[model samples]
Target: MPRGYGGTKGVRRPGVALALHFAFADLWHDRKLSVLGVILLAALLAPPVVLHTLQVGLVETWARDLAADLRNREVVIVGEHQVDADLLAALRAWPETGFAVPEPSFFVTTQTARLVGGRGSSVPLDMRTTSPGDPVLARADLPPPGQAGLILSARAAAELKADPGSEISILLQRTPTGGAVERREVILPVAGILPEAHWPGRTGFVSEGALLGFGDYLTFSSDTPDYRAPEDDERWQSLRIYAPEVSQAPALRDRLQNAGFETRLMTDQVDRILRLETGLRQLFGLVLSLSALAFVATTILIQWLSVLRKRRDFALMAVLGMSRRETATFPLVQGATMTAIAAALALGLAAAMGGSVEAMAQGYLAQPTEIVRPNLIPLLAGALGAVALGGLAGAVAVVRLGRLDVSRALRGD
Candidate 1:
């Protein structure tokens, strides 16, 4: 053995070793109680979990809405037939605007997209085309507008089992160029798939130059007055624009209004999403309040009772020359130690359960989703907090015991 390692000169001091043995001996007899205390302490570590789950669903919904809003850009609305030649020219020259085609005011639709899944088919309708440089929002596939190709929305592509170079058909309502109600089936090669939009379950988009040709429900008539299907002209719908930052949306809207466009900022698409975030915060607070109250009440009550029940054993130790300081500090040590162990167990449980909880929250969301990564701050704080609250309560409850008559304790009366 090395010179100091053998213990003649320096190992742990003998007195320190003896104290360690005695402390362990005392703790050994009470090991079951310690285990029980730890379990109780850990049970209180559940508040943060409930709150974080609510946050996950909310943030998921918020992101999808934000992405959709960004894609929609800004819309420009014209007064009824107010898009005169001069107004059209002025609007057309604006750098941010694209597809300056005339269309109606309110733009929305519900349509079914048919897919040719897993088979090879042939026909003129089977070979569709769109212009190459289509000004697409969040173009997952790069397709140039004006080229003969079709850009499908992510939902559309999925519905059609489509990919680049696949030819597909659009079912539009008919207009009689000659005599009959001709169902126009324009086949375009699938040039690209747009990103998944936050708008759920449906898909719509177009090549830059193309108007929404027509719909299946209405046929164009001449003398009967229902000639062009409603959305064929672009001027009807408000002009949509996008800014680099969300903070710029209001500013851009104001500027456009000032420029004499009858504009109402429709960020309801975005605001409705953010409203979900607010709801989540409120829900989290509700969960937190209930959880915190339970932990505080249960922990303080149990720890304080345990400390009092063990007072006589402690009082005898004091009579045997253990100091008043030792008597006062014992409950603190026991409470903190028990709480610390519970904290460790709770951390393990939280981590194991976090992913599952987050997934559940994501499923509940109405928007884009991201995986949850529970941070360490809550875990660490929870444990230490329990320790503090429990120790304080335990020590306070034992304060009267520390002042007890040694004779009464000794006389067993």
Candidate 2:
């Protein structure tokens, strides 16, 4: 009915395009109010964003550090229990198994050994059996296949004054039933040194064959003129098992316990970290829900009041042939635009807050780690959620607009 409401030839302008145009014009006309609304929305949204970023960042940092340690995934088979090849093979075949190596009986695991060309002091060290894929030796070079080399822990190396390319003389002693105590001195080359963080205390890691040989000599006095390697069917007294992931440690431990193996694992530590993450997320969720509800309520009240004040203007539009749907789109578009701008401002504020936290944390930490890592997916989802809340608020205003009596409002009634 109005000249400009429909284009020439009675072709109506696209409703959304026209609504958007009016929305922008109205927002610009009340630019100061719009800007104030944006500031309020951003203030409400920023705290949740910063809190979430911190939670995710700190939890992720802890998780990564725990994962990097590798020991958290390690499952130690306690005491001397016979582990046959069949059982070891079954464990190796398990999906959770990342690495598995057999350890000799406890008696032979520790022995007095001294570096040949250095301090010359014999240090009693626990010798662990290591294979090619051992997680403990991930950073260290593996010993030559068989029994020619050893990797010493930082403490052991420090006490022995040992270094790579040096030699160590280990004394292997055993007494047979009713036989004299036999002692044999064997020399092994130092292949590498393990970091203190990995092995800790006085410890040495040797090949499975070398450990087995030491066991044979100690158990059966097998170091005669002719020495033969042990058979493939030899049963090991213990095993060093590791899971590929921290999450898998619990399942693997449970599986081992179910199979009648007495084992010790860092599952408790992993579980504690996992529980902390869950608790933080739940806490954040509660805070975010409350904050979001307040934001929505405030937004809806603002939009509703704005519509009420502009009832005459909307009534005039209706008289000029603008449909209710087109009028509704005006508020929807305005709400979405304001929300998007507010979300952007909130994200920027969150980032600034996170950076401040990270800088402070870095000053105190020996090893600097990221305490404010922002992930893309969650950030995008948060922005979308803000926009959706805005749309919901606009919908409420639209409901109020739908009930407006156009003729009475236009007549100043």
Best by TM-score: 2
What is the overall TM-score of model 1 with all chains considered together?
0.56
Measured with C-alpha atoms, the lDDT of residue 232 in candidate 2 is 75
lDDT of each: 0.53, 0.80
User: Which candidate has the top score in lDDT?
Assistant: 2
**lDDT by residue (tens digit), candidate 1, 1-413:** 56664554654334433333443454467788767766765766655563563365346435444554544444535453444445656765665444344443232132334544445332222111123332443334464534335566666666677786676765444445676764444455675666675322334444333333432223342222112323333343333344444434455556667777776544545544456666777877786677678766766676567655665666677666666565655655656666667767877776677667666756755553665565668657766777787677656755765666767666654
Stretches of model 2 off by over 4 angstroms after superposition: 1-48, 139-145, 174-182, 224-228, 278-298, 312-330, 356-367, 388-392, 410-413
Q: For model 2, what is the C-alpha lDDT against the true structure?
A: 0.80
Error of 1 at 46 (Å): 2.6
lDDT of 1 at 385: 77
TM per model? 0.56, 0.77
